[model samples]
Target: GSDGSPQWGTSAEDRDPPGGDRSNHTACPKQRTVHKCELLHVAIVCAGHNASRDVVTLVKSILFHRKNPLHFHFITDSVAHQILQTLFQSWMVPSVHVSFYNADDLKPEVSWIPNKHYSGIYGLMKLTLTKALPSNLSKVIVLDTDITFATDIAELWAVFGKFSEKQVIGLVENQSDWYLGNLWKNHKPWPALGRGFNTGVILLLLDRLRHLGWEQMWRLTAERELMNMLSTSLADQDIFNAVIKQDPSLVYRLPCFWNVQLSDHTRSEQCYTELSDLKVIHWNSPKKLRVKNKHVEFFRNLYLTFLEYDGNLLRRELFGCVRLTVTLPPTLQQALEELDEDDPCYDFRQQHLMQHRIHLFFLQYEFLALPNPTDVTLVAQLSMDRLQMLEAICKHWAGPISLALYMSDAEAQQFLRYAQASEVLSARRNVAYHIVYKEGQFYPINLLRNVALANTQTPYVFLTDIDFLPMYGLYDYLRNSIQQLELPQRKAALIVPAFETLHYRLTFPKSKAELLSMLDMGSLYTFRYHVWPKGHAPTDYAKWRTATVPYRVAWQPDFEPYVVVRRDCPKYDQRFVGFGWNKVSHIMELDAQEYELLVLPNAFMIHMPHAPSFDISKFRLSAGYRGCLQTLREEFHQDLSRRYGAAALKYLTAERSL
Candidate 1:
């Protein structure tokens, strides 16, 4: 029931139909319950020429794609309002939602002080913060529209929703906990800001906001931070984090992938397949994303020309093969059915909202909002008989621990030749391993695990390889060993014991599916380079393995996988041509996850197959190297010639002075 309303809840029996529901407050008609929802809502903050181009491309992206039906709302500067509005409506669409006004229209200005203050926002994209949020958010999907939504908005709203216990207010509750660990100011860093958050994409929870006096919160934060600092790294993002973190009751947190963008570490596309339930794709200034190389354009071109990809994988990527079906609410259900019969937006406000509200209830509060927090179903198929073989992967198993899963296959007869060389390390272990095949790929089962990890459920996982030998009582000894270091977060789980002269990372407690995915994606890159350089393992690894029995789990964890600030995800500069050396991204993810690379004095793990077959005799990292250089150059244009030239050079040659 709506507390401030004229009674909103009904005690009817579930109102939900068998596999679908028609009684939703905003349900559509039946003829077509499935249609692309591409209506666009944009907040244009800057009006300079380049900003204009960005908006133009943004507008065309929405306009040119006829398959995606859309509506546009342009929030422009007061001075240029007239010209912008004309250009905005010039583009054809099913509808044009134009609100050409000054940033002053956002917050009420009772006097002259307010009007002059409006000019302040114009200084640096303040319209994004000054604009009045929608009072009626019934049909709005706030978008930068700078991105191409190869998928639909309706698909997102259909599968996802907010936490509706208190009437889900917003669809996205950002994961900004990671970077907030340390705060930065005027080139100086603060130890903490509680948690860092990105306010890129928001699924407005209007009615709830109105009821809870939500506008007051945004207004306050803006006045305090946006109006004060005017120079925070997160910008509007910082103000948003202040509002939500302080008021838990006002908003519900959505899952990790809902508004996926760049973390200081992760990229949206790289983790796209992993974030299974992603709905709205916030192409957050994608034109500016720091990718591999100038070749990052190659990826952009590939995405735009997705339909033109070559071969099977390219074709699958461009014209995605994702099968989708969504059940709409009664009003939308009705509107959809009558579209052929010509239904107008005459009663859109009242009827459309009623239906939208009901369906929104299911999407936000139930399944889609979060990843399967506790495993539900795997992507692969299995008979009911095989289901029992799959374990629940208990939550406790996910606690602070690192695990490493790797797979490898030698030409059947080749194993016989290496047996003699593999005898140095003696401990044996058993864990699940899946075999994947490709013509000439070095299938180190664990290489994929090394790459795809985003944020682990548990802090610690292993970094040991398949051909590696483990010291006896390794787990018991790790307990006493880690108790000695002062890692950033005492909760950190880095157990890279230097035993038997080999060192490996204790990465995290992950899912079997995750390990499988790591394998799947790893094969895509691992065959290009060596997983581990042959002679890198320490010769004194055995003695260290014997020395760790008396240590305790030490060190602090700087990154918290449980509550991440989405911006911390590692991003790949696409210009990176190839060692495909970019595979090192996996280590970066762990670093972002708060694991440190500990050079051991005496610890080690056994690597039965310690050679990287991928770094072939004719290895030419130049193309891949140049690709990386170009990506950095493009992403940080000025930095390429100044700040990052040296770093970029080193990245390309895998040497400091390259």
Candidate 2:
């Protein structure tokens, strides 16, 4: 190839076999001992709504072609983290390990760099990799979410052997003339060496970059460029190009076919002569797949192939008996036994949280097909003890239910056996079970709720607890009401009146009229009517007794009614764990977001009496637990005010005055 760069594409005979050793040609002394079986470290920055889907496709493409083990480091927001955690946990791919780092934690490092790109601050997260990742990691390959691979990634990893001592990064030349200032009149791009480099696929020598003080270098380059330009239009790419323009020897130019850019204005014809020669497809345009390229269909179909690939085939069991497990070291096990039993806050202490990892969707069972698609799904959470209630709930609801079950590693194994033997629980095709496990005493109540809510596929969801039994025909009633009430267009939450009974063995009510009779006879009462009147007072049971149509209810403090809301409503705040203020904080956010709460005329849910949760028992017995709950409540209100503004806090003030 010209310019001393490797050829864009090579025949099978010219390249090493898949996972073949190439340490003899290595240039960096630190990577000389690298073996073919070593885990390939890959970093990605994913945030926002659709990023998870794209990232899944990207990962699928890599898994399809790669032969070695993989370790993925995701820098993501809370939403993407939950979604991805649910997916990769259930995926159960052999030799794959995933780790998530909060994107908010890395924002401050690159927040000051103003970006004009559509991704905004998220596009600049790559700059923080040298500091965000652990110091022990020596090298990594960073990829953009909008990419698909057609060849084994080991070939790209092998490129590290070609890097000179002075070269700390490997990248392909930009396929467009955007950096040449030729796309439009008066165009001024950040400095570059000739055509500049595309960052979509990069080989990062982390140890080398750290030794060279990569952070300070890029910051200085960005500061110098900002003096002339208003802001960077390409985020990290612009700053990286400026730095490389100053020091040309710091980068090793990779084959252009590795990044065949499909942007609207891409000039990739000079990179590869045919679509078959391209190794990686990069849909860099905002209108991905729809971009104006002659070879768009070829790349689009490749991406679709991975997107729709059956993930079941990738499970570890398909190959052998390689099940995932969570085992603590002997030293950590001994340390946990020495914890003080008298400490009231021991369960939620920093030591416990630090030692345990919360595994989301540790085990999952999803229905591949259903006779009739459901309009509304019941989203609920429970522990292993409540697993028996699922059969009754599924029998009565007669619709889809997305359940998040919290359990230990042993309980998860027990659940699998229990589901197989129970006909109603296992044969019902509309129920999806997502199992979560964490080695801690306190329950992550809101975390479970958010996981269930995020995984729901229906247009609307009925948010409730596993202990509550819905009134018969509630699913059909809501399906009909959703059309007549125009619920699809309105920003509303249809409240379902709830009641509680102390008798463990009593006939469940079949209609609202039966429930009203039970209320009058004192066999049933509004849930927590006397103990916590403020909780359900906003529903106005007096008006609901004879009302035939939905009625609007004013927002009030401590109101937490089970309601059927659109699936895309605000997520529950995860900070409110261990029972107190969890559901109320979510209701308050719905109120703050201006969602109208309309009491449904027919729907009803009855809370069956059961043993109180561990968190509830602790709250009642421990003063320390109550104090922590109070502190969290105050912090939640303050955060709500900052998010939705002062006008949103007026509801709290109005409720207090009353």
TM-scores, all models, native as reference: 0.35, 0.52
What lDDT does each candidate get?
Answer: 0.34, 0.80
Clashes of each: 123, 0
Q: Give the alpha carbon lDDT tens digit for every residue of 482-541 in model 1.
A: 434443244333333321112234332143233234335542111112444222232222
Maximum-lDDT candidate: 2
Per-residue lDDT of model 2, residues 1-658, tens digit only: 2224443322234445457756765562222222335578999999854676578779878988766678899999886787687667655577788999999999989898889998899999998899999899988999999999998787787678667779998999998888998888999999999989999998999999999999999999898999988799998899889999999999999989889888878788678887667888888987887887777778888987886565444443213223333334667667667666666545554333333223343333343343233389999999987887888898789888888887654565478679868988768756766656554457888878887898777888999999999988999998887777888878999999999998898699888888899899999999998688889999999999999999999888889999888899999976666868889889999998889999999889888888888888888898988886766677777888889998677765855676
**Model 2, 335: alpha-carbon shift in Å?**
29
Cα-based lDDT at residue 421, candidate 2: 86
List where candidate 2 sits over 4 angstroms from the true fold: 1-34, 316-658
Off by over 4 Å in 1: 1-46, 60-69, 78-83, 107-139, 159-178, 183-196, 221-231, 255-257, 263-271, 274-289, 293-299, 302-658
Clash tally for model 1 = 123
